[model samples]
Target chain A: MTQQISTMTATETVIQAENVNIYYGSNLAVRNVFLDIPPRQITAFIGPSGCGKSTILRCFNRLNDLIEGFRLQGRITYHNHNLYAKDIDPVSVRRHIGMVFQKPNPFPKTIYDNVAYGPRVNNYEGNLDELVESSLRRAALWDEVKDKLGENGFSLSGGQQQRLSIARTIAVDPEVLLMDEPCSALDPIATLKIEELMKDLKEKYTIIIVTHNMQQAARVSDMTAFFNAEATAEQGGKVGYLVEFDETTKIFTQPSQEATQDYVSGRFG
Target chain B: MIPAAQPQKSVDLGDLKIDHSSRRSLFTIAMTILASACMLLTLIPLIAVLTYVFLQGFRRFNLPLLTQLPPPPGLTEGGIANAILGTLIVVGIAAIISVPFGVLAAVFLAEFGKGNPLARWVRFATNVLSGVPSIVAGVFAYGLLVKTGLTGYSAIAGGVALSVLMLPTIIRTTDEALQIVPKEVRMASVGLGASNYQTILKIVLPAAVPSIITGVTLAIARAAGETAPLIFTALNSSFWPGGVLEPISSLSVLVYNFATVPYEPQKQLAWAGALILVLMVLMTSIAARLATRQKTY
Candidate 1:
């Protein structure tokens, strides 16, 4: 019930969730929650396994609609539009808000085709070569894959495939980028490269990332939200609840809540 | 008391044991040999038939036998050229009619259908259709086409019959091929903002091309040797077909007719026709295998 609006006037809020609760059939996964994500800033959602951080992230674009028996009692707004509105289309919502999965899931296609897929589907009729090049450049992958555009996407190294997937997503020119553990399957060097890319991408797009690594959250995020699970008496089940949301520096250095402090200091998940 | 102080003398030991498992392994070897012999016995008839056909037909493998039309019963100077052409035309027509429909049906079942009840029913019906005998399909086509006076006993009718026989096989095989395409590729396409249709067209189909080709080739091979369907629909004509509406003679029907004749030359011609059919089927199967060469990097 805390309606703590931000005092900062210049930052534009791009996404907001109000009293959100997600369920799979009768199983309640995420409890009541409210969150505000600002444009051109990296917001990281970190929590222990099964705390529903990724589930909440998927709710932003309604990706959870693909699952059977998945339902939500909440309002998630992207800019001025309610994403779950009856008149809205999930495909259009996805085109505007792209997602990068945990694993590098590049299509079994040529590198060029993989990048071109998104643009073509979105009916982008501009200069394709330039679009692909710019998207790959923005993803920091153009230099590595420029010579091998004809090669299969699966032929790339795991790290490179992840970057190619990012390039594919950016080719559609989505306004918001949601990454779910984008670097968990990568090595340290690949992780560093992605972190750097995230920093550059935030200048143009709003980003919300769910990561397990606390250090990654501290290093890349501008705003951090800590989520924890609490047992619900009515349902006889554990439901994830937001513990704290603040400036990343304050959350890591001087948290307002004891739970956030415990989570950040590695005392408890 | 050191009563009967234990004897300190070393006792003699028996010789070391030798493993007898290897000796007992001979029984397994004997059983395996017997099983292999039984398998070989089962294959004897197939080998003997092939060998007999080859021995009798090799002498007829001349240019004239392939290029000339069937001669009068007393003459031995004709070939199976018209029959081959007729077979090619009918099979080509059948393929044209069936391949696209079959592949599309497969795409519906494998990609768009997912868990749709209608797709499941269609799939089940297709399995049932595949199990139906080729002669039954021929009879159905005869009843539908001949009874309607739509060029009774014509090449088109034959093509329709063959297509019906080929449809279920093509659909089932293509569905299996599309199913084998890794879900990761589909997910990647969807994640990139591609619509379901786009994902299927770009990602799912391409990855399954090899298997699809394999399936189509096998179907074609099966269609080439089908005689019952052609007998009922195309009937048998001594002359070449002028158009789709005219009856035509295929190699299978030609072989069947020639094999039943009471002449030495005709029997020889039948053997030659059989040899050509086997060769064509073999080449097709080989081509299919070649097309599916796995590419890994």
Candidate 2:
């Protein structure tokens, strides 16, 4: 019924994946992923366990390149620059596109140093103290840590450490932020705080979060992508494929695919 | 009295409870006693040795015990300070030679060398090296350094021997410590765009530092106590160890040399040297154990 609404407006598509397939050694891990991630939007990848949702999320910044046998047959472009092109340095790509892991994997440094690490390594010439303060403030962690910035990063509680990791990622002034279930290791209250922080973050950065919790995707993401696996004899096991991609509200309400319909209704993942 | 027939009152099967006691039995008590007895049995020799050394050594303790050289035969007035200084200098040199190679080898095995044939071979060599007699290490160093004309029966030669003995221990322990550093920590660093070198140097190595220090300290202690390696390499000198290139008298070697002599004063000095050596090793090992208690996270 909508006449002239393009799925992704011209200015919106910051990252576009064209026919993506990932492999680990000989196993086709994920297949046939065609998606466009809008800039300054919180996009969530929601799926069941071991569906390679995390695997696909890692590919956005070529984080998957670190894996021993990881291979991708896909054209993933960041603002139309081929990320996998031989000339494109993966380290610089990762520098511009930061990531927060599922665990609160802070470096064994003081809280201040943890946040300052990225900026330092990338040779950020700006005032470090101000940057650390502002980043921590943005992550809702400054007030709690201001007096004890020299303490080890692990001295903080689980949620605080997760926030510290986010601060660390943002301190580098990245164009895109990748969060792999950043709240899974946190308590419910902490998860709520992270979700709220995600909402505020979209004002300045594009964020792609991979989440196992369906409600989290519904609550925070502007758009949602669902992935599912199907057994294939040729592949010799189940390999993940993107099942649905749409506005979060629509995907949760009136999804076009039967699998999406079943998933949102909690019938099956 | 008539158990089977009487319990037909349904036995209240749901009300019946199985024993969940965690209490120890007679067998457990007996085993604990046996283990303690076995431990005490082994400790008997240790206590006897320590007590004997202390009894003989304490009577000769004076300011000169740390300030003067050993006395001539029949004279019981001086101390083995030359040997003490010699031991420190030789062990220090060994640590200097061993630590860098051990730490680097460990880093390679833990980071880049996992499952690689060359690393596996090196690790295997280290294991074999750990098992080799310290005297053999001394003989090898004697042939390589002393006979080969690099340095003859010198402290540096002794250090090389001790380094050979210490390298395997340091490498194995450091490798184990590095392996325990969570992969996520490394991934976190690399994910932040740090290169492999940066991630390992700034993150992985620092995280593994405490445990590595413990291993390095223990390796030093072990090298400090080694007597056989020094015999073929360092030999013995009554004078203060001049430098790494000169013949050195380590406490272990001095004890070996004195204990075999027929003189009474020399025997007493040997007892004192033995005491100092044991205490030095004991202190270093305790410090290492404490360092190991620091959390890797």
Which candidate gets the maximum lDDT versus the true structure? 2
The collision pairs in model 2 are: none
lDDT of 2 by residue, B182-207 (tens): 98888788878899999889998999
Kindly report which residue stretches of model 1 are placed more than 4 angstroms away from their true locations once superposed: A1-11, A228-241, A250-269, B1-50, B294-297
Two-chain DockQ for model 1 = 0.51
Q: Candidate 2's chain A scores what TM-score?
A: 0.96
* B55-111: candidate 1 lDDT, tens digit per residue: 888988899877788888887778888888899989988999899999999999997
Candidate 1: clashing pairs of residues: B68-B79
Q: How much does candidate 1 score in TM-score?
A: 0.88
Q: What's the i-RMS of each model? A: 1.9, 0.9
Q: What is the TM-score of chain B alone in each candidate?
A: 0.89, 0.91
